[model samples]
Target: MAKITFIEHNGTEHVVEVANGLTVMEAARDNNVPGIEADCGGACACSTCHVYLHPDWVEKVPAKDAMEEDMLDFAYQPDEVRSRLTCQIKVTDDLDGLIVQLPEKQI
Candidate 1:
């Protein structure tokens, strides 16, 4: 399992242990971490689960695919470098201590 940390725009943080084969979005939803709306569940159909990766982890996580890149356009105040859809990130041992920050609001 990976210990992921979800940080709100206001700095509130929710840390949870997520098992492998699950997406980071699942961790947030299951743990009731505020800010990740996950409006489309894990289907990648919406940008409500948008988040910003901690600088230290920018290259550690998987790269975005064409679909995820496109979906990010709909996220609120997306940062070209840090924005990512939590659903697109799967949990793994490598992601232990993963940290992400939510946007001020989801779009």
Candidate 2:
């Protein structure tokens, strides 16, 4: 399992342990971490689960795919270097201490 931290726009933090094979979005949704609407239910079809990786974690997680990059365009205030769709990021031992910041809103 991995312990992921989800920080809301206002700085509220929710840290939860998630089993491997689940996506970061699922972790947030299951733990009721506000700001991650996950409207698409972990599908890459929407950007509601968008988040910005903490600076220290920018290069640790798996790189975003073409579809995820494309979908980010629909997120709120997306950052070219830090923005990512949580649904596209799967949980793993390597992401045991992953941290992400939620946007002010989802688009």
Candidate 3:
């Protein structure tokens, strides 16, 4: 399992040990972390699961694909370099201590 930490816009922190192959959005939804609406489930078809990698963790996660980039255009407040769709981030050993911050909103 990989340990993932999620921080809300106002600094609420939720940490969960996620199973391998699960998406980060699944981890948040399973743990009840606020701000990750995940309207499209894990399909990567919506921006409700948008999150920003903590500055310190920006380089740890893999690069976003074209689809994720396109979907991010609808996110609450996207950051070109930091924003990501959690559904696109699958949990793995390499991201054991991954940390992500929720956007101010998820509409």
Predicted structure with the largest lDDT when compared to the true one? 1
Sorted on lDDT, best first, the list reads: 1, 2, 3
Best TM-score goes to which candidate?
Answer: 1
By TM-score rank, best first, the candidates go 1, 2, 3
| TM-score of candidate 1 against the unseen true structure | 0.98
Q: Each prediction's Cα lDDT score? A: 0.95, 0.93, 0.92
**1-107: candidate 1 lDDT, tens digit per residue:** 99999999999989999999999999999999999999999999999999999999999999999999999999999999999999999999999999999999998
Worst 10 residues of 2 by lDDT: 34-43
Q: Which consecutive 10 residues in model 3 have the weakest lDDT in total? A: 54-63
**What tens digits encode model 2's per-residue C-alpha lDDT throughout 1-107?**
99998989999889999999999999998888888898889879999999999999999998999999999988999999999999999999999999999999998
In angstroms, the error of model 2 at 82 is: 0.4
- The all-Cα superposition gives candidate 1 an RMSD in Å to the true structure of 0.5
Q: Tell me how far the alpha carbon of residue 28 in candidate 1 is from the true structure, in angstroms, after superposition.
A: 0.0
Tens digit of per-residue lDDT, candidate 3, span 21-104: 999999999998989999898898889999999898888888999999999999988999999999999898999999899988
**Better by lDDT, candidate 2 or 1:** 1
- The local distance difference test score of model 2 is 0.93
Which stretches of candidate 2 lie above 4 Å from their native place?
Answer: none
RMSD of each: 0.5, 0.6, 0.8
